[model samples]
Target: MVRFSYEGSSERNLKMIITFDLVNTSNSDGRTSLQDESRSGRPNTANNDWNTARVDELIKVDRRVKRKEISLKLDILKTNIYESVYDKLGYRKVSARWVPKMSDEHKRQRVEISQILLHRCQQEGDETVE
Candidate 1:
């Protein structure tokens, strides 16, 4: 079996040619650890086991602490937190700002700004500020 892997500036593609010996069989002699292969291909262990307390702690840190701070405290890579944790938990290592909080503040600010703009427009006849 031959496998060719090509890497480009932006992407990678793989091509494989299976030989007869590489084919799978129902017999135990042909079996291999699929999990091992998958795990080998997966990203390294960084944030696999997380408890509730740890998650909460991470969230707290994400709220106020910087990535460097969190990495220093947790002894993990900032990239791991940003890639794995943020993707899975929807919270960065720092600034785990909640959507609800932002939504409320954004709505309030928009309303206030619109009111101000409308008032200014009414007074000055300029609609561009809104």
Candidate 2:
């Protein structure tokens, strides 16, 4: 059957969109809408398998290595996956470090590197090598 549906809104300016949700009800089994019903029991979570595996690898490595290495591995995994390691494991890998905090030594080293860079910038302004 042919049906015409019109929807519009007026704010600041004005806009209108005419949506044609055409329905062939004669062969639709008495259905009038165009949406299909979803199946019950948990949605598909297949895409997260890689992250889950990475989390497992991290856990296994945690028993044999330091936390910093695990943190770096987690960063690599995130760079490659672009998603939360914990969320991807069907909430199973809760121990995965999504954002590992920098250690005091790491922070100190970063500060020293920044200071050295600043000194270099100041020196470049003060002298020219011939």
TM-score of 1: 0.35
Q: Candidate 1: how large is its RMSD?
A: 8.6
lDDT of each: 0.57, 0.54
lDDT of 2 by residue, 93-129 (tens): 2344334445689899999999987788778964533
For every model shown, what is its TM-score relative to the native structure? Answer: 0.35, 0.25
In model 2, the Cα lDDT at residue 61 comes to 50
Residue 118 in model 1: shift from native, Å? 16
lDDT of 1 by residue, 43-123 (tens): 666766563235447656456656566666677788866654455555532244522123577789999999998888888
TM-score of the candidate numbered 2?
0.25
Backbone N/Cα/C clashes per model: 0, 0
Evaluated at residue 98, the lDDT of candidate 1 is 28
CA RMSD of each candidate after superposition: 8.6, 14.1
